[model samples]
Structure formats: structure tokens, C-alpha cells
Target: MKLYSQTFKDHKIVFIFFLFFLICQGFFSTKIQYERASWSNVPKAPARTAYVLSFLGDEALAHRVLSNLLQNFGGSGGRFVAISDYDMDTVSEWLFLGNSLDPKSEYLPFLAAYFFGASQDKEKLRPIIAYLEEVGVSGGKEKWRWLVQAVILARFELEDTDLALRLANKLASLWRPGMPAMMMQMPAFVQLGMGEKEASYQIMTELLREEGDKMHPNEVNFMVDYICTRLLTPTQKESDPLCIDVP
Candidate 1:
């Protein structure tokens, strides 16, 4: 009983000191930890400002905005998806500004256009392609090539063949020495888009004749078979004397 009383007395003294220390510290110190999101005071400026800033040697900022836009479109995920119309417009405006500021920046505009073509609606692709053409006019060979790649993606992946063909023809007309011969395929695509399968077949036939020796045997055979298949549909073969046989 005496030992227990002494232990109680010791604990009471320690508790009183602990309480006193806490009170003393609490009076002088204030600790507040809560969930607060990071905030930036910098406004998301308008495209005009962004354009002006980029034109005035702030190209890095433009790149940053482009990067942020790409992230929003799920570009970081390796497969971009369509965004809302308003967000698309915002991203497009920023892209126009960025490309307009640095016409020679092939990668940014090329990537933006490719992602846009993959993810954007057909209604908006026309203006985007027009903008790319305008930029390609002054963006030199490398830029033009990249823009052409973006158009091809739109053609095959986005099913926007008409727009892609239009851009392709424009790029072909502006052909540089290093430009690939694939640009010439635009005419075939144009014919296909217009429901003129015969014209497309003729174009493919000419391509095979002109480039057959240069292409791998397998590739050549593939092209010939593809053309023949399209030209020699079962229903049309009976009446279609124009069907050219491959082999």
C-alpha cells in the first residue's frame, strides 16, 4: 500500500509537469496542418498574350503550355482521347499561337496536329489542317514532313480522308528534294474519297509500275494484290472488263 501511494505521487508530479509544459508551449506555438491545394497567382492568360509573349522570345513558356495541354488530353498515357469542345478550342488557340510564333518548330505543331487529328471531331479538323498548311508554307522541309505525317495519320486513323488528301496535295505541290514519294499518294486517296475507285486503281497501278523495282518484292506484291482486290470486287468482276489482274 505504501509503495503504491509513492508510485501514484510520482505519476501525479510527472503529469502536472507535462501539463504545465504543454500549456507553456501551446501559448507560444501555433501548429495548423490541413489540406490545402497548391495555388498559382499567375493567370491563365489569353492566346493573344501567349502569342505576344512567345513572339517576344518566351518560347519556353509556349512549350510549357503545350506540354500542359498535351497532358490534359491524356497524351502522357500513350493514347490520346477526345476532349470537350471548349477545351479543344482552348488547346487549338494555344497551338495556333505557338506555331505562329515559331513557324520552324516542327515537333510541337506536328505532335499537336497528330494528337488533335486522332482525338478531335471532324467538324474541327478542317480549320486545324488549314492552320497547319499555313504554317507549313514557311516551316521549311522538316516541318513540312512532320505536318505531312500528321495529315496521313488523320487520313488513315481519323477517317478524315478528304481533309487529309487536301493537305497532302498542298504538301506535294510544295515538295522539296528530300520529300518522300508517299506524298503523291494523295491523288489516289482523293479519288477514293470521291467514290472513283477506278481512278484510284489506275493511280495505284501507275505507282506499282513506276516504283515496283525499287520496292521489296513482298511490298510490291501487296500493293498489286490490294489494287486488284479493290478493282475486282466479286459483284463487279462479271461486268468489269476494266479489272486489271495482278500477276
Candidate 2:
């Protein structure tokens, strides 16, 4: 009787330990599911620039000053703002008088591009990109942080998925020393395109085990999985992860 009781106690201890381990693992995995996306930090600009501009500069003076400069200057912040054809001993006043960067300066390129050009010309988008890039926000949250998103949003807002995808691909390509975002999400696209539900999540089983997109190292694993999930077909029943070839 004593021997049986001791053996039963040992079995109970082992089962308790096993349960504890499983519980810990579950909590840790759940914590990972709610992290934020790296792209979320950056965002698109709103259509409220006129208010901002009016608050920052003399609205009337700025407008009047902009009109004269554009007639001849082409762009406001080019190297020669003061010289009306600087050191023009052979000439006179500049036909255009755009914005300057400093308090005494103006913002012609930004103004002209944002206020007038962006709607009619896709090329106008370059200045926004260029401004972000020049300000050293190409790959970070501070400056170019939300630039790609903004570009994509612009394309989408214009009802142009083609442009949005083009911009997304470009940014993802420049994932800066890494694979394109679409490639990693390729399985999802493939699953959705081929109409597979189980296969979609199956790909996640493998990817979740590995490290995530290298370029955007800060990416949340579950979020990556979520993106893949977006591509899953809605019609299929759910099940355990399968051994997908990802072909």
C-alpha cells in the first residue's frame, strides 16, 4: 500500500509540472500576438495644409510673393532665391518671387507641388518623397517613417491600386538590404489566388517558427502572420498547419 501511494504521488507531480510548462508557453505566445506594426508609426499627411500654411506664414503676403516668383524662377527654393539671376550686372529683377525656406525665405516647390501639381501629375509625388528622403527619413520613423504608407495612401485615395502597389513594391524592395514584403507574403497571395484556406495558415506555421522580414526587423511576428492571413480564402475550413511546399 505504501509503495503504491508513493508512486501515485510521483505521477501527480510530473503531471503538474507538465501542465505548468504548457501554461507558460501559452501566455508567452499570446503576448506576441498584439504587437504594433513598424509601418504604423509613419502616416499620410492630411488635406489641411492651407490652415497650417496660413498659420505659419502671412497668407496674403505669401500668396502674392509666390505669384511673382513662379513666373520666372520655376521653383521657389532653388539655389538662387535672392539673385533674380544673381549677380546680374547684365540684367534686372526676377520675374518670379516664390517662398523662402527661412523666416525671410519661402516654400515654392512644396507649395506649388502640394497645392497645385500632386493632383494632375504623378511626378509631383517625387517632391514629397524627396523631402522625406533629404530629411533622412528614408528608413526610420522620424522622417521618412510613414512615407511609403503616405505614398500608398495617395495612390489609393486617387483610386489607383496600380500606383499604390507600385509604391509598396518599391519601398518593400528597398526594405534596405532585405527581401521585398510581397515575397514573404507571397504564400498568402498564392493561397488566396489559388483558393486555399488551410494552406494559407499552414505557411504561417513554418514562417512563425523562423525570424521575420529581415529588413524591417522590428516587425511583429504575429502581425506578419496577420498579413498572410489577409490573403487566405474565406471558404475553406480551418485546421492544423499542413506541410505546404509554398510553390
Candidate 3:
């Protein structure tokens, strides 16, 4: 009982002292979270701004506002690029800005496009591919950028037979070592988009053979449904002769 009493007293004294410290800090520190940016009180920078603002940004206009901040904090050559490198995880957006500001930046737009699905707008992808073809890829890491762009374009269902075949060949060569299992499923989609039914089936069956695991009931059910959904869309009969790909 005596030991317990001493422990309680010690904890109580610590808690009281900590509360007093917090009260002192509160009186001296600026309440930055409630303060907004203005002429007299412009924020130093978004990342350097208080924690609350950074946390608030992801949902509340973060992507766009960050773009604006990067633009305002000096151009791509200076602190803006530094801020982007230090603060942002998705380097693509700032890369887009960088590449646009300096045409020589080969990787930024491609990286951004990959992260933000920048090529989803088919019209935008045309210019991106044109830029790539003109300036060309940079580093060893950059080869993957074009390969990824090609694959992304294929997924958009924009590329026809020749492009699909070319991309498949490139992916085969470049991606053989680190072949992400999920991507093997893509050839089926690409082949089907090209109206090659038998080829699509063969590729998809290969994917199933390699990746399918039914040890868990949930996994089995999910694979079954995912495969079935792709294979049996209402517009195409299961026995349709024109297709062989994942729907």
C-alpha cells in the first residue's frame, strides 16, 4: 500500500508539471493553424508551414494547391524543385512542371503521367508520346518510364494491333526479370483489344496457371469471379469468336 501511494504521488507531480509546461507554451506560441495566408502574413512555404495545414491539404485542394505553391515559390530551377523533392511523394506533378519549364527534362512528365494517370486523356497522351519520341529517354531507370507509358496506353484501349504488339515485345524484353504477376494478365486485354481471341485465351490461361491459388476460400472466389466477369460480358457471348482476353 505504501509503495503504491509513492508511485501515485510521483505520477501526479509529473502530470501537473507537464500540464504547466503546455500552458506556458500555449501563451507564447502563435496559433498558426487558424491563421491563413495573406500579404502581411504569407506562409513561408506549404511544406514548411505548420503541421495542421499540410495534414489538411490532402483532401482539401492539396493536389492543385501544391501545384500553385510550387509555381509561386520560385520557378523549377530553385527552391520549388527542392520543395518538390523534399516534400512530395508523388514527384510526377512537380516533374510535369519541371519538364514544361525546361524541355530537356525527359523523365518528369512521364513519371507524373504514370502516378497521376496523366495519359488518361487520350489527347494529352499524344503530346506526351510525341515529346518522348523527340527528346528520348534519359537514364537506365528511364527505359521503364516509356515501357510503363506504353503499357498505360494499351490499358486505355487506344493502341491497336501494331502498337500493342510492339509494347508487348518491349515489355517482354525489359520486364522479364521483374515481371509483376498481375501484369501478365494485361496481354490478354491487349490481345482482345486487337480482336485476337485464341491468343487472349492462351495468355489468360497462362496467368491463371501461374498465379491462381485456392488455399483460401476468399481467394478462390475472388479469382473465379474476376476471371468470369472479364470472360463473360453481356455484349460478348462466352463463345464469341472475336476475342480471347480479360474483359
Candidate 4:
């Protein structure tokens, strides 16, 4: 009887230890995952909805929330350190999801594109440009201007001139009366980048004439002079009006 009682006590103690170990293991696992999610900077839905993400799936509201979150993530101090490569990737993923929720909204894509451009991550910027290009195509004629601006940044800042020119050509074809002149001028700029100086000059000359036809001839002269002075070198050779290199 004594031996049986001792064996039973040992078994109960072992069972208690096993239960304690399981509890500790679970607690640590939950804590680690929570920390990971926190550092990831992805806003999580509440548990009452069974974490279904139904609440966050609202398009406009989700965009607003994402804007606020991005602002918070972009702030100074401790947050700056948290915005590492991994964190940036995670934030971009969140932005992508937010855009998916509100694909038609100009706010989210533009806002996220600005952030991604500042990131200087070529991989990240590609997707942003792609998304905005789709927006430019399907949304409205007005949105093409935004797409042009994004593409210009890709060309000058990111040095992705091929995509930039392609987008610039796309936007130029859709140009409207009220749209910005830069939309029409971007293809010329891309041509300059591609070492086609004469082609760019001719395009710019044509663009100046088009602007002059719009009843603002003097205003258009300043634009042409600005483009030639800043982007091209003046030469005594009138035959080659705008040379890529100084004569």
C-alpha cells in the first residue's frame, strides 16, 4: 500500500510539471507572436469579430486608417528605427492591401506611391508605378497627370527611363486641354535621357507651337526657353538649335 501511494504521488507531480511547462511554452509563444506583429506595424482587427478582418475591409475607412497608420509609422524618434527594410516591406504590403480595398480611390495609391518613392527601393517603386498606371487607365482622364508625375520620378530619380518613357507616351496620348504641360513635355525629357537630342528638340519645338496655338504665346515662350536653357546647351550652330552637350 505504501509503495502504491508513493508511485501515485510521483505521477501527480510529473503531471503538474508537464502542465506548467505547457503553460509557459504557450505564454512565450503568444508573447513572441504579439511582439512580431507589433513591430510589423500592421494594424490588427479586434477579437470580438473573431478577427475576421471584416471591419478593416471597408475601403474608404481602411484608407483613412492606413493613412493614419503610415503617418504614425513615418514619425520621428523610436519609430524611425523601427522602419527597417523588413518593416518597410511589411508597411508596403499593408499599403498594397489597403489599395486593394480601395482601388479606385486616388488617395491611397498616391499616398503610398509617395512613401515608396521616398523609400528609394526600386522593387517597391515598380509596383507602385504599376498600380498608379492602372489607376490612370481605368479611373479617368484626370488621373493620367498623377501617373505622369510618378513616371517622371521613376525616370529622373529611379533611373528607370524605359518605363518612364512608356508611361509618358501613354499619358501624352491621353492629354486634355486642362492637363498640365509637363504631361506633354515628359516624352521629350525621356528622349533626352535616351540620347536622342534632336528628336527631343523637335518634340519640344512642336510642344511650344501647340502651347502657342492655345492663345498664350508669350507664356509658352518662357516654358520653351526654360526647357532649352536648363535641359540643353545653346550653340552658335542654328542648324542644331539644342545640343545635348555644350558647343
Counting clashing residue pairs in each candidate, in order, gives 0, 11, 4, 0
lDDT of 2 by residue, 122-218 (tens): 4444444333223323343322223333343234324344544454444444544433343344323332433233433444444444434332432
User: RMSD to the native, candidate 3?
Assistant: 14.9
Report the lDDT tens digits of candidate 1 across residue range 29-53: 6542332333222124366664556
Tens digit of per-residue lDDT, candidate 4, span 199-236: 44444565555444652444345435535664455442
Give me the runs in candidate 2 sitting further than 4 Å from their true place. Answer: 1-137, 141-159, 172-237, 240-247
Give the RMSD in angstroms, all C-alphas superposed, for model 4: 13.5
TM-score of every prediction relative to native = 0.48, 0.23, 0.30, 0.50
Would you list the C-alpha lDDT of every candidate in the order shown?
Answer: 0.56, 0.37, 0.43, 0.57
Q: Is candidate 1 or candidate 2 better by lDDT?
A: 1
Q: Candidate 3, which ten residues in sequence have the lowest lDDT sum?
A: 78-87
Return the top candidate by TM-score: 4
Better of 2 and 4 by TM-score: 4
Q: What residue runs in model 4 are displaced by over 4 Å at the alpha carbon? A: 1-53, 56-58, 74-77, 82-93, 194-247
Candidate 3 segments exceeding 4 Å error = 1-111, 114-121, 130-139, 142-146, 157-161, 176-189, 194-247
Better structure of 2 and 3 per TM-score: 3
1 versus 4: better TM-score goes to: 4
State which candidate has the highest lDDT: 4
Model 1, runs deviating above 4 Å: 1-57, 73-86, 157-161, 192-247
